[model samples]
Target: MKFNQYIFLLFSLFFLMSNSYAEINIKKCKANQGDYIIFDEYDSQIAEKIIDYKLHNQPEKRENSIIKIFANENSDDRNYWLASIQTDNKAEDYLFYQVDQNKFTEVDQQQFQILLPKIVECNQIKEVPIYSENFDAD
Candidate 1:
């Protein structure tokens, strides 16, 4: 009887905690480059431009959001950066991009596919290079 009571209490507590939790807010999008983009709101258009990003929606997503874009002598592109946008939850699952400086011309496109699909409570997302010495790589 005592075991049953404890089990019931545990489940009740779990339900309450889950209900009290809120949807994750994208505080920042960390990318591979030396820079990162921050998004308080969901902007599908902006997210398409950035190359690599880390979504702070959850721990799994946060860790998965870390995308790596490598540039080398053989690489054609010299400059690469990460960008993110705040979009409405009801908006399209995929983010479409257009040229803002060129009067909304279609320049490029990126799909908001999560490389990391787990959710972690993150206050902010800052760019931290995987191979950077600052992160104790040495």
Candidate 2:
């Protein structure tokens, strides 16, 4: 390659490398003990079947709330850097975006979905709900 072409290629590689992006775990969405990810945007219709999510007029609160940590990315397309579904949210979810992450009160249409639900507590005596899809016999 010519000297100028070589320089151009080197510059391009440097430019690409300079841009930082969030590290994502490609594992299929599941519960984690600590902070995990929520890569996919919300789909309300699909969520209704697999897990019991936010229901209108009835605030859902359990002993534990499911959460995921979204590292800030360098893309203009996505604004949410963090998303959460607390038991105290009163059936509504929240999205924390890049602009004012600590202050945002409402979830946007682009907010990440709760793809993985962390099972918290099972208090029923002697009987497990075998009807649950997530139930594991082992």
Candidate 3:
């Protein structure tokens, strides 16, 4: 009986360690950008960069806005870009994301509260068009 328990404990530890390592590797891959490595909680490394981006752009045009880029929770797809638009005062300005080759969707405050009861917030997200332009080839 003791031998069986030891085997089970070892197996569990091995599984847990391997699983965590895989997750860390994936996060590292996603966070890699040129010479800099973005760790799981390395916002400070890029915080100045985002702030600098806002500073360089014209305030009248950009409205002191910055887009905080984040990796998608669902990583099975590689063609999507997920981010959030932030204002200087507000924490949640809007969810700005791109899907495949289509439009850039924005989930603003008006649409965020329409989730169904007891449903998860992120899973309940639906894409909504933020901009569209029509052109004539003729």
RMSD of each: 16.3, 15.8, 18.9
Candidate 2 ranges beyond 4 A from true positions: 1-63, 73-80, 88-92, 99-105, 108-138
* Model 2, span 46-85: residue lDDT tens: 2331223332323233334443334222222233233444
| Highest TM-score scorer | 3
Candidate 3 backbone overlaps, count = 0
In the range 80-129, model 3's lDDT, one tens digit per residue, is 33344555565654432233333344444543333111112222123321
The 10-residue segment of model 2 with minimum total lDDT is 117-126
Cα-based TM-score, every candidate = 0.21, 0.24, 0.28
Clashing pairs in 3: none
Q: Candidate 1, 80: how far from true, in Å?
A: 24
lDDT of each: 0.29, 0.34, 0.37
**lDDT by residue (tens digit), candidate 1, 1-138:** 999999999999999977663332232322233233332222332333332222334444333332332111111221222223223242222222222321211112232233112111121232332121112322
Q: Which residue runs does candidate 1 get wrong by more than 4 Å?
A: 25-138
